[model samples]
Target: MTPRIVILGGGSVGMYTALRLQRRLRRGEAHITLIDVDSYMTYQPFLPEAAAGNLEARHVVVSLRRVLPRCTILNGVVDAIDTSRHEVEFRPHKGPPRRIGYDLLVVCPGSVSRTLPIPGLAENGIGFKTIEEAIHLRNHVLGQMDLAESTQDERIRRQALTFVFVGAGFAGVEALAELEDMAHDACRYYPSIEPADLKWYLVEATDRILPEVGPEMGMWTLEQLRHRGIDVRLRTKLESVKDGRVVLDDGSAFDTDTLVWTAGVKPNPVVARSDLPIDGKGRVRATPFLNVEGYDDVFTAGDCAAVPDLTRPGEFTAPNAQHAVRQARVMADNLLATIRGTRRRPYRHAYAGSVASLGLHKGVAQIYGVKLRGALAWLIHRTYHLTKMPTLNRKVRVLLDWTLALFFRRDITALGALTDPRREFEYAARTTAEPVAHV
Candidate 1:
């Protein structure tokens, strides 16, 4: 019987692991299967652009079946992993949970949206982690414009134009910049909606935005956003958001229909249930080789795994796409070496700086001690992600979107009603049909 290998989480780690494993293993020596909740591997870096209308939403995600033709892909969420029995449990859509046995297990279930226990947050604020949320945000932003333009009441117009975003990191900042740019462009068609009336507020409990890009860059971002008339509040916190009324910790209040939560993410909660050793944040503890400590048969990587950062003593690698992709390669190579009964190498890499987009033709990047701003940074940000995008087809589509965007006006049509198309039908059904002569 061939060595059975099962990799969990179909995000960057799972997909890249399959690709690397197929490259290393030849002639069907090992049977490999990839499992994930969704059939598509989302290129998360493009999510902000997808939400902002910079890239077509469809182009940001790659179909798992199309990319992993050689590997068996299981579509579902993994429930539990029983190392004692070499079996894993999963719950597929509309089916009872089932178990599958495997000789080698790779745990890479990615992270989930990390949220706080603030009042009404779960009920009102939307997360920005998935493609669905991205689409919803786009539609919501555009729909708000429509409401603002059509509303006769001043209060309704003000509420419709007010947009609130929490967490000033890459997700919040880029999303705000992109959506603001789109909304500003969209106002050209709505004579009643003035650009000044559109309020874009970014609330952060920190001192600056884009902390991933270092302090200097982060401060620069704060200044740039303020210059653009964005009400960016630093060292402030959200008190409550019940009933669309946003109350800040510093005694501020606002009523807006939009609230975005992109604060951060915690490791998958499943790690705590497993017998695997976990850190304070509920992440599986692993050596730099990506193998779970005390068990060579079990390996882990990506956001869910707490792989030690050899470059920085006493610190684990931060959860980011660059590290995740690089770690996957090391993980695959180490897995191959383990099967061959050879020595395995540890994973070690240094930070390579960060890049962030600020609307059109504007961005910030600091790479290897070199700082770039404006269109150059934006161009670099785009070019780099384009190269890192999963497949040639997706890369082509994303690039084409950018090329077309250069020549075409921004497309900002609010389709919020799409979220519930049956609303109109239900209302139509309830209302008595207009009396008409028999035909």
Candidate 2:
């Protein structure tokens, strides 16, 4: 009988792994089934660009059906897995739960935002993970500007103009900078709302930001942000955001309607529930070969697995897209090797470097010990990620968007109605059903 290969999640690892497997696997060699709740895989590095209207939302996501048409795509979530029985409990988007059997398993559920319990954080704070969150944030930021500009109430205007972002990691910093730039550019349209009125605050619990880049670059980036008049609160924690009132550990208090959470991410909770052996950090224990420990048939990678770093002894690869993409290649090859009875290579790659875009034409990069800043860094950031982005389809669209930006200004439209698109129709239906008064 042919082997049944089941892949869980459709992020960086799962998507690329399946993409490779489907290409290499012969007819009847193995049956590939990929399970993910979302039908599309989001290229997350461009999420800030998407949010800032640099790239269209649809362009940033690759349709799984389009890319992995050869593999079976199940639009569902894996609730549980009984490794002993070689079965996984799957909960479809809209149906009864069922168990799926497989000969070989690929666990790549990825990570969820690691949020701390601060007062009113859950209600007020939104994460920067999904494409929805990114787009919604864009609308919300622009909407807040609209509210500030139109409002006569001083307190409300103040609150509306103030934007607070917690966790100064890549996600936090990039988002803050992009949105701030957008809002500033938008101020020209709103005569009352000056750029100075927009009070942007970036709060990080640590002393530094963008730890991926070296300390010198990180410090330079910090200086650049502060120079732009952004309030950088290092060694600070969000004490609370109760009722849109922001409080900080540094004894600062303010009111802001916008609070973005980009603290960190941990392994998906479902991993723990599964039978896989997990490390202390709540990730699957993965060997250098990209297979789960003590399980030859079962493999795991990406943020959910603690993959050992061969270059740096006693260290696991950091949970990032860089490592995840590389790991997927090795995992797919090893899976094929296992089936063909061939040699399987261990997943090993030294840190390539980090590149981050601050705003339109501003960025920082450190590629192979060469540190670059400003417009040149920005170009490198776009160039590097453009190549890595899956499919020529998406790459062309992203490039077109950037090219268009060169000639045109950012589309700062706040389409908040997209959030609840059916609201108007539903309201009309409800009102029309009632008896109409004859005039």
- Candidate 1 lDDT tens digits, 16-103: 9888998789767788888888998898888888988888888999998888788899988777888889888877877898998898
Off by over 4 Å in 1: 431-439
Scored by TM-score, the top model is 2
Q: Compute the lDDT of residue 382 as modeled in candidate 2.
A: 91
- How far residue 5's Cα lies from its native spot in candidate 2, in Å, is 0.5
Tell me, by lDDT, which candidate is best: 2
Q: Which clashing pairs does model 1 show?
A: none
> Counting only residues 3 or more apart in sequence or on different chains, how many pairs clash (N, Cα, C under 3 Å) in candidate 2?
0
Q: Per model, how many backbone clashes are there? A: 0, 0
Per-prediction CA RMSD (Å): 2.2, 1.8
lDDT of 2 at 326: 92
Candidate 1 CA-lDDT value: 0.88
Residue 282, candidate 1: alpha-carbon lDDT: 85
Kindly state the number of residue pairs that clash in model 1.
0
